[model samples]
Target: MTLERITLAGGCFWCLEAVYEHVRGVHRVESGYSNGAHPSPNYEQVCSGTTGHAEVVRLDFDPAVVSLRELLEVFFTIHDPTTLNRQGADVGTQYRSAIYWHTEAQRALAAEVIREANEHHGGRVVTELQPETNYHPAEAYHQHYYARHPDQGYCAFVVASKVDKFLASFKRLVK
Candidate 1:
Protein backbone atom coordinates (compact mmCIF):
# COMPACT_ATOMS: atom_id res chain seq x y z
CA MET A 1 0.00 0.00 0.00
CA THR A 2 1.23 3.45 -0.84
CA LEU A 3 1.62 5.82 2.08
CA GLU A 4 0.98 9.54 2.08
CA ARG A 5 2.38 12.16 4.37
CA ILE A 6 0.80 15.24 5.90
CA THR A 7 2.05 17.60 8.53
CA LEU A 8 -0.24 19.46 10.88
CA ALA A 9 0.11 21.90 13.75
CA GLY A 10 -2.90 22.16 16.03
CA GLY A 11 -1.23 22.69 19.37
CA CYS A 12 1.48 21.06 21.39
CA PHE A 13 3.14 18.32 19.36
CA TRP A 14 2.79 16.05 22.35
CA CYS A 15 -0.99 16.37 22.27
CA LEU A 16 -1.24 15.75 18.54
CA GLU A 17 1.22 12.89 18.67
CA ALA A 18 -0.63 11.22 21.53
CA VAL A 19 -3.94 11.29 19.67
CA TYR A 20 -2.61 10.10 16.33
CA GLU A 21 -0.57 7.30 17.87
CA HIS A 22 -3.82 5.50 18.60
CA VAL A 23 -5.37 6.14 15.20
CA ARG A 24 -5.70 3.20 12.84
CA GLY A 25 -3.98 3.40 9.44
CA VAL A 26 -1.55 5.95 10.82
CA HIS A 27 1.75 4.26 10.05
CA ARG A 28 3.84 6.71 12.05
CA VAL A 29 3.63 10.06 13.76
CA GLU A 30 6.68 12.18 14.34
CA SER A 31 6.72 15.39 16.34
CA GLY A 32 8.60 18.21 14.67
CA TYR A 33 8.83 21.87 13.76
CA SER A 34 7.67 23.15 10.39
CA ASN A 35 7.47 26.33 8.32
CA GLY A 36 10.25 27.82 10.39
CA ALA A 37 12.90 30.27 9.25
CA HIS A 38 15.62 28.47 11.13
CA PRO A 39 17.21 25.54 9.29
CA SER A 40 17.53 23.27 12.29
CA PRO A 41 15.65 24.60 15.25
CA ASN A 42 15.63 23.06 18.70
CA TYR A 43 12.56 22.86 20.91
CA GLU A 44 13.70 25.93 22.83
CA GLN A 45 14.04 28.07 19.70
CA VAL A 46 10.66 26.99 18.42
CA CYS A 47 9.07 27.55 21.81
CA SER A 48 10.59 31.00 21.96
CA GLY A 49 8.32 31.92 19.01
CA THR A 50 11.26 33.54 17.30
CA THR A 51 11.96 30.70 14.86
CA GLY A 52 8.62 31.17 13.08
CA HIS A 53 8.15 27.45 13.63
CA ALA A 54 5.03 25.69 14.73
CA GLU A 55 5.10 22.46 16.66
CA VAL A 56 3.86 19.96 14.09
CA VAL A 57 3.41 16.24 13.59
CA ARG A 58 4.41 14.54 10.37
CA LEU A 59 2.03 11.65 9.77
CA ASP A 60 2.51 8.63 7.52
CA PHE A 61 -0.73 6.91 6.62
CA ASP A 62 -2.22 4.55 4.14
CA PRO A 63 -4.84 6.48 2.18
CA ALA A 64 -6.79 3.31 1.48
CA VAL A 65 -7.43 2.93 5.19
CA VAL A 66 -7.60 6.54 6.36
CA SER A 67 -8.48 9.28 3.89
CA LEU A 68 -6.90 12.69 4.33
CA ARG A 69 -10.34 14.12 4.90
CA GLU A 70 -11.06 11.67 7.69
CA LEU A 71 -7.70 12.44 9.24
CA LEU A 72 -8.49 16.14 9.18
CA GLU A 73 -11.87 15.45 10.72
CA VAL A 74 -10.22 13.70 13.64
CA PHE A 75 -7.73 16.53 13.87
CA PHE A 76 -10.47 19.14 14.17
CA THR A 77 -12.31 17.07 16.73
CA ILE A 78 -9.26 16.76 18.97
CA HIS A 79 -8.18 20.39 19.02
CA ASP A 80 -9.80 23.79 19.25
CA PRO A 81 -9.09 25.11 15.79
CA THR A 82 -10.99 28.35 16.45
CA THR A 83 -8.34 29.67 18.80
CA LEU A 84 -5.70 31.75 17.06
CA ASN A 85 -2.06 31.02 17.87
CA ARG A 86 -2.91 28.93 20.88
CA GLN A 87 -4.46 25.78 22.26
CA GLY A 88 -5.61 25.75 25.87
CA ALA A 89 -2.90 27.21 28.12
CA ASP A 90 -0.18 26.82 25.50
CA VAL A 91 0.05 30.30 24.03
CA GLY A 92 2.36 31.06 21.11
CA THR A 93 2.68 30.87 17.33
CA GLN A 94 4.11 27.37 17.77
CA TYR A 95 0.77 26.25 19.10
CA ARG A 96 -1.29 27.73 16.25
CA SER A 97 -3.78 25.73 14.21
CA ALA A 98 -2.40 24.90 10.81
CA ILE A 99 -2.49 22.31 8.00
CA TYR A 100 0.57 21.97 5.86
CA TRP A 101 -0.81 20.42 2.69
CA HIS A 102 1.62 18.41 0.60
CA THR A 103 -0.24 18.58 -2.69
CA GLU A 104 -2.76 20.67 -4.63
CA ALA A 105 -5.43 18.09 -3.95
CA GLN A 106 -4.57 18.07 -0.29
CA ARG A 107 -4.73 21.87 -0.29
CA ALA A 108 -8.24 21.79 -1.75
CA LEU A 109 -9.28 19.13 0.74
CA ALA A 110 -7.90 21.15 3.63
CA ALA A 111 -9.91 24.18 2.56
CA GLU A 112 -13.00 22.06 2.15
CA VAL A 113 -12.55 20.61 5.62
CA ILE A 114 -12.21 24.09 7.10
CA ARG A 115 -15.31 25.23 5.24
CA GLU A 116 -17.31 22.26 6.38
CA ALA A 117 -16.14 22.70 9.94
CA ASN A 118 -17.17 26.35 9.97
CA GLU A 119 -20.55 25.54 8.44
CA HIS A 120 -21.18 22.83 11.00
CA HIS A 121 -20.04 24.96 13.92
CA GLY A 122 -21.13 28.37 15.09
CA GLY A 123 -17.72 30.07 15.10
CA ARG A 124 -14.95 30.88 12.66
CA VAL A 125 -12.26 28.34 11.72
CA VAL A 126 -8.88 29.75 12.64
CA THR A 127 -6.91 26.87 11.12
CA GLU A 128 -4.51 27.99 8.45
CA LEU A 129 -4.14 25.95 5.23
CA GLN A 130 -0.63 26.37 3.94
CA PRO A 131 1.71 24.57 1.56
CA GLU A 132 4.00 22.03 3.13
CA THR A 133 7.63 23.03 3.56
CA ASN A 134 10.72 22.07 5.47
CA TYR A 135 10.18 19.93 8.56
CA HIS A 136 12.79 19.65 11.33
CA PRO A 137 12.38 16.92 13.90
CA ALA A 138 12.04 18.19 17.42
CA GLU A 139 14.38 17.17 20.21
CA ALA A 140 14.50 13.46 21.01
CA TYR A 141 12.82 13.95 24.34
CA HIS A 142 9.73 15.37 22.66
CA GLN A 143 8.91 12.38 20.47
CA HIS A 144 6.31 9.97 21.84
CA TYR A 145 6.39 12.08 24.94
CA TYR A 146 2.97 11.22 26.27
CA ALA A 147 3.57 7.51 25.84
CA ARG A 148 6.98 7.64 27.43
CA HIS A 149 5.92 9.87 30.25
CA PRO A 150 2.32 9.01 30.91
CA ASP A 151 2.66 9.81 34.60
CA GLN A 152 4.27 13.19 33.96
CA GLY A 153 2.25 16.22 35.03
CA TYR A 154 1.54 17.72 31.63
CA CYS A 155 0.93 14.33 30.01
CA ALA A 156 -1.53 13.27 32.65
CA PHE A 157 -3.40 16.57 32.59
CA VAL A 158 -3.21 18.16 29.13
CA VAL A 159 -2.18 15.46 26.66
CA ALA A 160 -4.34 12.80 28.25
CA SER A 161 -7.44 14.98 27.97
CA LYS A 162 -6.93 15.35 24.23
CA VAL A 163 -6.24 11.63 23.87
CA ASP A 164 -9.44 10.77 25.69
CA LYS A 165 -11.36 13.15 23.46
CA PHE A 166 -9.90 11.62 20.34
CA LEU A 167 -10.66 8.08 21.49
CA ALA A 168 -14.21 9.02 22.43
CA SER A 169 -14.92 10.96 19.25
CA PHE A 170 -13.21 8.66 16.78
CA LYS A 171 -13.81 5.21 18.13
CA ARG A 172 -14.06 3.74 14.65
CA LEU A 173 -10.66 5.11 13.75
CA VAL A 174 -8.88 3.88 16.80
CA LYS A 175 -6.68 0.82 16.61
Candidate 2:
Protein backbone atom coordinates (compact mmCIF):
# COMPACT_ATOMS: atom_id res chain seq x y z
CA MET A 1 0.00 0.00 0.00
CA THR A 2 1.15 3.52 -0.70
CA LEU A 3 1.57 5.90 2.21
CA GLU A 4 1.41 9.63 2.76
CA ARG A 5 3.49 11.65 5.19
CA ILE A 6 2.29 14.19 7.72
CA THR A 7 4.38 16.04 10.20
CA LEU A 8 3.06 17.55 13.39
CA ALA A 9 4.28 19.29 16.49
CA GLY A 10 2.14 19.39 19.58
CA GLY A 11 3.64 19.70 23.01
CA CYS A 12 6.36 17.13 23.47
CA PHE A 13 7.34 14.84 20.64
CA TRP A 14 7.19 11.97 23.07
CA CYS A 15 3.48 12.41 23.54
CA LEU A 16 2.67 12.67 19.82
CA GLU A 17 4.98 9.76 19.06
CA ALA A 18 3.27 7.57 21.61
CA VAL A 19 -0.26 8.21 20.38
CA TYR A 20 0.46 7.79 16.66
CA GLU A 21 2.27 4.51 17.27
CA HIS A 22 -1.05 2.86 17.99
CA VAL A 23 -2.93 4.49 15.11
CA ARG A 24 -4.24 1.93 12.60
CA GLY A 25 -3.12 3.42 9.26
CA VAL A 26 0.11 4.76 10.60
CA HIS A 27 2.98 2.62 9.32
CA ARG A 28 5.88 4.59 10.76
CA VAL A 29 6.32 7.48 13.17
CA GLU A 30 9.63 9.22 13.66
CA SER A 31 10.25 11.97 16.16
CA GLY A 32 11.94 15.00 14.62
CA TYR A 33 12.54 18.73 14.54
CA SER A 34 10.73 20.78 11.91
CA ASN A 35 10.18 24.33 10.58
CA GLY A 36 13.46 25.51 12.03
CA ALA A 37 16.45 27.33 10.64
CA HIS A 38 18.94 25.33 12.60
CA PRO A 39 20.11 22.43 10.51
CA SER A 40 20.74 19.25 12.42
CA PRO A 41 19.59 20.83 15.64
CA ASN A 42 19.86 18.59 18.67
CA TYR A 43 17.27 18.14 21.40
CA GLU A 44 19.14 20.55 23.64
CA GLN A 45 19.08 23.26 21.02
CA VAL A 46 15.35 22.73 20.49
CA CYS A 47 14.58 22.54 24.22
CA SER A 48 16.44 25.80 24.68
CA GLY A 49 13.58 27.30 22.67
CA THR A 50 15.85 29.31 20.41
CA THR A 51 16.06 27.21 17.29
CA GLY A 52 12.57 27.97 16.06
CA HIS A 53 12.06 24.24 15.93
CA ALA A 54 9.05 22.38 17.21
CA GLU A 55 9.41 18.81 18.37
CA VAL A 56 7.52 17.09 15.52
CA VAL A 57 6.62 13.56 14.57
CA ARG A 58 6.59 12.60 10.90
CA LEU A 59 4.20 9.76 10.19
CA ASP A 60 3.81 7.51 7.17
CA PHE A 61 0.29 6.25 6.81
CA ASP A 62 -2.20 4.83 4.36
CA PRO A 63 -5.16 7.13 3.84
CA ALA A 64 -7.33 4.09 3.19
CA VAL A 65 -7.05 3.00 6.83
CA VAL A 66 -6.88 6.51 8.30
CA SER A 67 -7.90 9.67 6.55
CA LEU A 68 -5.82 12.79 7.01
CA ARG A 69 -8.80 14.42 8.63
CA GLU A 70 -9.10 11.54 11.04
CA LEU A 71 -5.45 11.95 11.99
CA LEU A 72 -6.01 15.65 12.62
CA GLU A 73 -9.06 14.83 14.69
CA VAL A 74 -6.96 12.59 16.89
CA PHE A 75 -4.26 15.26 17.02
CA PHE A 76 -6.62 17.96 18.25
CA THR A 77 -8.05 15.70 20.94
CA ILE A 78 -4.67 14.53 22.17
CA HIS A 79 -3.41 18.05 22.78
CA ASP A 80 -4.85 21.41 23.69
CA PRO A 81 -4.75 23.15 20.32
CA THR A 82 -6.07 26.29 21.91
CA THR A 83 -2.88 26.74 23.91
CA LEU A 84 -0.09 28.75 22.36
CA ASN A 85 3.49 27.57 22.57
CA ARG A 86 2.81 25.23 25.43
CA GLN A 87 1.14 22.04 26.55
CA GLY A 88 0.51 21.50 30.24
CA ALA A 89 3.70 22.61 32.06
CA ASP A 90 5.90 22.43 29.00
CA VAL A 91 6.25 26.03 27.87
CA GLY A 92 8.22 27.17 24.83
CA THR A 93 8.02 27.53 21.09
CA GLN A 94 9.34 24.02 20.94
CA TYR A 95 6.04 22.87 22.31
CA ARG A 96 3.85 24.89 19.98
CA SER A 97 1.09 23.14 18.04
CA ALA A 98 1.59 22.88 14.30
CA ILE A 99 0.69 20.71 11.32
CA TYR A 100 3.27 20.38 8.58
CA TRP A 101 1.34 19.44 5.51
CA HIS A 102 3.05 17.59 2.70
CA THR A 103 0.60 18.46 -0.06
CA GLU A 104 -1.96 21.08 -1.02
CA ALA A 105 -4.71 18.63 -0.18
CA GLN A 106 -3.23 18.00 3.23
CA ARG A 107 -3.08 21.73 3.86
CA ALA A 108 -6.73 22.18 2.96
CA LEU A 109 -7.82 19.28 5.13
CA ALA A 110 -5.79 20.69 7.99
CA ALA A 111 -7.48 24.05 7.60
CA GLU A 112 -10.95 22.56 7.55
CA VAL A 113 -10.21 20.49 10.63
CA ILE A 114 -8.66 23.42 12.46
CA ARG A 115 -11.65 25.63 11.77
CA GLU A 116 -14.09 22.98 12.97
CA ALA A 117 -11.90 22.25 15.95
CA ASN A 118 -11.88 25.90 16.97
CA GLU A 119 -15.66 26.00 16.83
CA HIS A 120 -15.94 22.80 18.84
CA HIS A 121 -13.64 24.07 21.54
CA GLY A 122 -15.25 27.52 21.60
CA GLY A 123 -11.71 28.86 21.46
CA ARG A 124 -9.33 29.83 18.71
CA VAL A 125 -7.24 26.90 17.58
CA VAL A 126 -3.67 28.11 17.57
CA THR A 127 -2.50 25.10 15.65
CA GLU A 128 -0.59 26.26 12.56
CA LEU A 129 -0.77 24.56 9.19
CA GLN A 130 2.21 25.01 6.89
CA PRO A 131 4.41 23.20 4.45
CA GLU A 132 7.21 21.31 6.17
CA THR A 133 10.82 22.43 6.06
CA ASN A 134 14.10 21.75 7.79
CA TYR A 135 13.01 18.40 9.15
CA HIS A 136 15.63 16.32 10.91
CA PRO A 137 14.94 13.06 12.62
CA ALA A 138 15.38 13.25 16.36
CA GLU A 139 18.10 11.38 18.16
CA ALA A 140 17.69 7.63 18.05
CA TYR A 141 17.08 7.49 21.79
CA HIS A 142 13.96 9.61 21.34
CA GLN A 143 12.34 7.09 18.99
CA HIS A 144 9.44 5.06 20.46
CA TYR A 145 10.11 6.80 23.74
CA TYR A 146 6.87 5.93 25.52
CA ALA A 147 7.12 2.31 24.50
CA ARG A 148 10.64 2.17 25.85
CA HIS A 149 10.03 4.20 28.98
CA PRO A 150 6.46 3.61 30.08
CA ASP A 151 7.48 3.76 33.71
CA GLN A 152 9.06 7.17 33.34
CA GLY A 153 7.14 9.72 35.34
CA TYR A 154 6.33 12.08 32.48
CA CYS A 155 5.25 9.27 30.17
CA ALA A 156 3.13 7.63 32.81
CA PHE A 157 1.59 10.87 33.97
CA VAL A 158 1.25 12.85 30.74
CA VAL A 159 1.73 10.76 27.60
CA ALA A 160 -0.18 7.70 28.75
CA SER A 161 -3.27 9.73 29.58
CA LYS A 162 -3.41 11.10 26.04
CA VAL A 163 -2.84 7.68 24.54
CA ASP A 164 -5.57 6.14 26.66
CA LYS A 165 -7.97 8.91 25.80
CA PHE A 166 -7.38 8.49 22.08
CA LEU A 167 -7.67 4.72 22.26
CA ALA A 168 -10.91 4.91 24.16
CA SER A 169 -12.54 7.58 22.03
CA PHE A 170 -11.16 6.47 18.68
CA LYS A 171 -11.16 2.75 19.12
CA ARG A 172 -11.92 2.07 15.46
CA LEU A 173 -8.78 3.94 14.41
CA VAL A 174 -6.42 1.98 16.60
CA LYS A 175 -4.30 -0.75 15.13
Query: Candidate 2 lDDT, tens digit per residue, 1-175?
Result: 9999999999999999999999999999999999998988999999998899999999999998899989998999999999999999999999999999999999998989998998998977899888999999999999999999999999999999999999999999989
- What is the C-alpha lDDT profile of model 1 across 1-175, one tens digit per residue? 9999999999999999999999999999999999989999998889899999999999999999999999999998989989999999999999999999888999999999999998877767889889867789988899999999999999999999999998888899999
Model 2 local distance difference test score:
0.95
Give the distance in Å from residue 107's predicted Cα in candidate 1 to where it truly belongs: 0.6
Best by lDDT: 2
Q: Any runs in candidate 1 off by more than 4 Å, and if so which?
A: none
Please give the TM-score that candidate 2 achieves against the real structure. 0.98
lDDT of candidates 1 onward, in order: 0.93, 0.95
Looking at model 2, residue 166 earns an lDDT score of 94
lDDT, residue 137, model 2? 97
